[model samples]
Target: MSKRDFYEVLGVGRDAGERDIKKAYKRLAMKYHPDRNPGDDTAADKFKEVKTAYEILTDPQKKAAYDQYGHAAFEQGGMGGGGGFGGGADFSDIFGDVFGDIFGGGGRRGGGQHRAQRGADLRYNMELTLEEAVRGCTKEIRVPTLVNCDTCEGSGAKKGSSPTTCGTCHGAGQVQMRQGFFAVQQTCPHCHGRGKIITDPCGKCHGQGRVQETKTLSVKIPAGVDTGDRIRLTGEGEAGEFGAPAGDLYVQVHVQKHAIFERDGNNLYCEVPVSFTMAALGGEVEVPTLDGRVSLKVPTETQTGRMFRMRGKGVKSVRGGAVGDLICKLVVETPVNLSSRQKELLQEFESTLAGSDAKKHKPRSEGFFDGVKKFFDDLTG
Candidate 1:
């Protein structure tokens, strides 16, 4: 039977890059792997086809020849297709390359020595008040993680003994397995890919080379940091097995809500209530700011919801730029709970505001009622 196109087998376009081809191959290989499919011959055959296509397309020389000749380049004994897939392509290397992230594959160390793995990264979520977030502070945090075992000096062996080479993989940390027509490399089950075994395990850590412990660390928060910001602390994560490098610790920041102020980016917003008399008569009012109380002049006949901007009163960005402004929205407050004498005086004042000058004093109410009357007249007409 004629073979299908390499691009079609991998479900990629002819102009696909190496990264794209590799990604496609990894996905298909995982789906049709013989171990995953068990006794399914169709999936095994598909896996073989995908493996061959990946091997050819990933090689620059082989891809150039195949693009020019279209499978005829490797037919018979042309470019190395005489023996097997891609003319004796190293299938073990391909399997390792595709599944390295999942399996953590590594070659044997120099002089047949075993190499320990690095530690895992960690994240810590921190909550801060708006004031503390805007103006920096230092915090001490305690984290529970794995630290190197002191009894055996992180060697995973008893005090007077050391680790021995694994008999299963012969210190190679990997073993080759053949299933049908394909050969793949996998981690050694006996050594668990460490290439060494502890004859006498450490009693403190039980041969793991690390022990659980809680550590305290101090983190300095920078000024103007907002929510969703992260501060990285290097080498503060779990300790590596044996003597490998430790991982990083990420501190995630979340700012708490404020009572009076709302923040948008670097700007700060707030609502200030003004008495109806103060709003009408134009006077200086004290407004609260992050720095201190400031005097704001209310213009004559100022309406509700009028915005006043105070320059440079907002937060200065941590990333460095111009400081933002503080925006204050005015709200005219209505008086409540009047005394009898005050009520009498207000009623008398209302009588004077009536008559022909009522529209002059309450123009908005007069215009609204006038529109309502005109609407009724039009409906009647």
Candidate 2:
């Protein structure tokens, strides 16, 4: 039987470009593939015909010759037989080109050499006192991690020998499996995707290219760094396999709780105790700050839980914003363990406000009773 025109077999015009031809061929080939239409000889023959047409048109030299001379250029009297032309080229080459990107095997047709993989990143948690976080300090930390082997220089081979490409994958690190006309790639079993095998292992790292060791590093803490802040140390993580680039090490900051102060954002809060006499008389009381003790003026008749702001007395932010304020909450303390003479003097002072003037001395107590009387009056009347 005279075969159909190559362009007609792929359902593309003769004037179609290579891209358009390939696109049409892929659509028709998938539709009439033998696996999709089993037990149909007509479809099977059609698949072979489509495959033959695609191979000829895609080849530069064959396409040129076929364009000028038609099928006569590949006739028995001319260019051998067109039936064997389909087997000359590997079908996997086309399969990889069409579906390689979806399957992650593009640009890796044959067993090519594999590149070294990068190392894993590491995290180190460091605890710092609130004072150290506010003032900024440097500390030395010891970390246990994998480092490149010194004896073998991370090659994983003995001093006299070297690693060899994997026999199964030929250094590709992946093996291609054939399922019918489909090719699937997976990590090579022999070398476990390392692409190289060490026949004679290194004495120090046991052919692993890395050794477990303790590393001591100094990390500088910036001022006003709060909890959850991370400092990155470049190329300080575990050594990469086969001497690839090392990963980074992250220093996670965790500020310890302070004894006298509580931090909210960049601000500091603390409670200061003042004598009731000093609160009522309006005197200067000493308050502790981060830098030093500062004098804070307590107003006359100052109540407990009244906040006093000390500007620029809190921590400076690490991100370089305005310095925060220190808020001091005052608590009036009552005198305790009074001597006999002192207790008598306090009783004398209390007797001065015992009558109708007691309301003027304790307004909060009078207001509490007024509210209580109103609540009971509403319940009864």
Candidate 3:
């Protein structure tokens, strides 16, 4: 019988791109794999046929020759038959492209199958005072993580003994099983895919290669660092198993609430309370800031809820820019617990001013009443 077209076997067009070819192969391989299909000889044979088709189509020279002369190019005594392409040709090159990485063979031959994997990253939450967040400070934090054991130097074996190659896989880290015409690769169960086993376990770490420990590290916080900012400490996280590269430590910042000031981006907002007398007759009052208390002038006739801006009084950004301003909202506080004499004096002052058109003195109140009257009239109508 004549061989089928490679593209037709993989269910792809002849002009299919490399990605499309790979995706088609992966889907077919997964579906027809012996382990998945179980005892189905037809699926196994189809799997092998697709694998072989993919191998021929993906190679530049083989694809070119096959395109020129069809199946005759790879036949028994054809042009490519005798020179390195005959019956003794190794199929591992094609197998590596398809199943090597998935089965833990490191994708290709002579690439040295396994090395230590990088450690997991860690996060540490740190609380900072508003003042400290604005000014920036260095803090030492203690983080619990896995560190390599010193006894066997991360080898996970006893001092005198070393790890041995796995007997089940013979140090290949993977095993191949023939089901019908198809070859399936899987990780070695004996070594748990590591290809090596420690016969003499380390007493200190119990052959785990790492130990639980607390590491104290200093992190420098930049100025203007707000809540939700992170400082990364490279190579400060958990130690990798078997002496792999260590991961990073991230310090997540949380700024504590300030009693006097609230921050919005680079700007600072604060409510400054002044006596009613000070609001009526201008005076200098002290206001609190991140740095220290500063004097702010309350202008005469300053209304309640009026905002005053002080340039360069807010935080300097951690990302670097011009310093922000401090916005102080003035709130007039009425005098309480007045003495009898003071009350009498205020009553006399009120009596003198009473007949002189209260609407002129309280224009906002008059305007509010006018608006209420108009709303009632509209509702009635």
Candidate 4:
């Protein structure tokens, strides 16, 4: 049978917090516990399911993977195989892993009694002009985050006073509880898994072991970076908890809209307006590019919507490809706001086109009129 969703199994929403998840799991476990259910096999299976769900949801790393990939994250060949809680695994170990402090149980100690929690990662949304994105630039940014407390050197205790071992769990950071035939371990209530209590808290950090402050950092942006690209600044995020490593800072890039140019991959596109005289007679005109103004030769009898490509005049890809071309789409602009002399000159020019070769001179216009005449004839017929 396909497994039910962990959130559904615990009867909680997807956004349920740590405390809510624990409380829900405890309620379900109590109802379906083998000790409470006696000889019911269904209840025992349910208890296993609930335990598996709680184990995955409570651990931040496991929960992140599960949230991203769903059940595939814990499958045998899928993510890491049944989340290391399947058949033949010790139930007591599973019990000890999560509920240790709850049941007043202690595990092996390390160099530091305080927990070494990783710092939170940070992201800075950076907006750059199109030209700046095409070319590399260095910038400085300010970010507000947590840093290690200097008063007690991140120990959280007042100067000259250190933390004492938890009296509840005896430095095990967990406690064991026996309910019927099962034993469960839970976090120590007194020390809350640090296994130590601070008699005097630091005045500077107020026992939080970190302070909030704004930090200035330098970021170098590489050329040809596009939207959604990010530059990683290692160890530039918030300070780690209890002397652990700091997280990474990611500067996400957003390119501002350009006035004249639109980019596609390494290529660039722009519309250049050509006068009717230039389109008909053909002449050299000045066009704008990133490299500055350049002369573009318009061929004789050039039509509107004709595209011209300038080679090696576009963007060089940040991902290392050939330099792209700039394609200019030509739009022939009709003359407007004519004076009386201009109108008389146009009328004289129109009279000159009344010759029989006029049809040959305007083949596209004659062909379109012919097609329209045939359409009306076919409809009447």
Candidate 5:
């Protein structure tokens, strides 16, 4: 019988791509498979035709020959046989490409696979006082972590009787499954990818290979570190499986709020209250900083909310930068409680200031009243 055209056999166009050819073959093969249509002679023959067409078109070398010379290329007068082109070819690779993940096949067919996994990282939050953060300190902290089991030497085996090779996978971490023309390799169920079976488990950690322990470690905090800063301590995290590299521990720093100062980046801000007399007639006042108390000079006619900068009194950054300034914002305080004699003296002083014909004492008050008078006149107009 003259064979049908390979494209026609798979119900795909001559310009169809490799994916289209495979899809068509898959549809036809499933519809007329011998197992699906048992005892049906026509279905069995149709399955063979579809399989042969797929075998030829799927091979680049054979497909090229068939495309150029037609069936004559594989006939007795030419390239030999087109009907059985994939008889001894490697179908495992092609089958794996389509059905590998579903059946757990493909690259894992080899028995030995990596079973050890990296340990999980850990974090520890540390709170420090503003003084401690500025000066730096060393503290001993206890952390609960997983340590390798000494009884089993981290192998998850018994002290006397060690683990044995898995009979199901024969020490290979994976097992093979043959489905039609494809081969799939999946993790061994018996060994769970470890390739070994612990008949007798360790007494300390059972079969886990690691144990929980509280470890004490000394952490050194550097000076000038603020909130949200992190210090990393390598290999101080949970123990890895089967002796793999351990994870790291991150120490997160949080600085407490200060009573005397507000920090902005490297700078420090503080509000200092001054007596009205001291502000009006120039005097020296005391200011607090992280270092110590320093004297700040209040100039004559110094108004409220005047910012006086004390350089080099603020924090130096942990990441390296010039030391910042301490900004003291002045606030004028009104005096309270006056004796009878004091009140009489204040009344005399007030009269003396009112009698003056100049704006020497209260220039700001005179200017503010002048603006207010003009605002009312405009409204009336």
Candidate 6:
């Protein structure tokens, strides 16, 4: 039987671009693939026809000869009569070229054998006190991970014996199969793509190259490290397979909450409580800082919520810059557990100041009342 024109089989013009040719071939191949069509002989035949068309069209020399002489180029032995369905061109090759990677066939070459791979990274969460974070400290941590076995030297083979080359792929790690008009390469299933087989496996690790172990690591935390800061330790992670390079370990910092102070960037804020007498008549008081306590002078007639700034009293940033200041907000504390005599004296003092206008001493309260009055007036009107 005479064969159809290659371009006609793929539904592409003779002058179609390479990309267009590939697209047309892919569409037809997918439609008639043996896997998709099952036992449909017609679809399988169409798939072979499509693959042969693509194989010839994609090759510059083959395509030129066919274009000039048609099928006569191969029939007269000009391009080899058995070339279309033999040699590198086959059905397996077509499927591997298109679907092998998706199906886990496109791995490190050598018959699908497993190779030495990098180890997995690890994370260690470290909790830091506010003072420690602001001042910085060196801490020791114990981490459990997989380490290369010293008994077998990470080979996973017994003493005096080592892994042997895979017979299935002959140490190439991959095997080629012809499908339709193309050659497809896939990992060797017998060796699991490792290209090597261990005859005598180590009893300690059961043919695995690593074992569980604990290691101590010292980490230096720079000053001004806030929450969510991470410190990386290279090559401190779990051991890799078959003695591959180790992975990294990350130390994540979590800053503990402070009882007296809150941090905002490099600044520190604290609420300092003062007696009503101190707020009214001003005095010097001790304020706590990360370094030590310092004296802060309260001015006469100081109001509640007044902030006092102490320069260079907060944390120094890890990233080099000017030291931050400590801001203290004053909160007036009412006198509690007053005696009868003290209460009587307070009553007398309250009566003495009663006739005076409260607005002069409580301007904010007076302004709030004025706004309420205007709101009611607007509603009534």
Query: Tens-digit lDDT track for model 4 on 1-381?
Result: 788988999999999999999989878876776655779989878888898888789999989998999888988776556444345534445544554422233323211244668899999999999899888899899999888898888888998998888898888765666775445565567887778788789999988788999999889999999999989999988888767788889999999999999988888899999998899899988878888988889998898999999998899978988988889999999899999999999999888877787887777888898899999999999
| RMSD (CA, angstroms), candidate 5 | 13.5
lDDT of 6 by residue, 203-269 (tens): 8988897899999999999989999889999999998988789999999999999999999888999
How many clashes show up per model?
A: 1, 0, 0, 24, 2, 25
Q: Model 5: per-residue lDDT, tens digit, 1-381?
A: 777888998999888889999889877865775555779978767776777788778889978998998888877656654334335433334344444432343322333554688788999999999888877899789999998998888888889878898898888777878877545577888988888888898889888889999999999999889999999999999999867778899999998898988888888899999998899899999899998888999999899999999999998888888998999999999878978998898889878777455367778887898899999999998
For each candidate, the alpha-carbon lDDT, in order, equals 0.84, 0.84, 0.81, 0.82, 0.81, 0.83
**324, model 5: CA deviation in Å?**
1.6
Provide the clash count, candidate 1. 1
**Per-residue lDDT over 140-253 for candidate 1, one digit per residue giving the tens place of the 0 to 100 score:** 999999888999888889999999989999988767676544455667889977888898999999998899999899999999999999999999988898778888899999
Per-prediction TM-score: 0.70, 0.71, 0.72, 0.72, 0.70, 0.72
Error of 5 at 247 (Å): 1.6
How do the residues 1-381 of candidate 3 rate in per-residue lDDT, one tens digit apiece? 566788888899988987888889887876776556678978767777777667678788888887888778877688556422224323345445565533334335423435677888999999999988999899988999998998988889988888899998888776776654445676677876677999999999999889999988889988899999998899998899788898999999999998888999899999999988899889999998877899998899888999999999998889999999999999999888999999999899778755548677777877798899999999999
In terms of lDDT, model 4 sits at 0.82
Pairs that collide in candidate 5 are 105-184, 105-185
lDDT of predicted model 2: 0.84
- Candidate 5 weakest lDDT stretch, 10 residues: 101-110
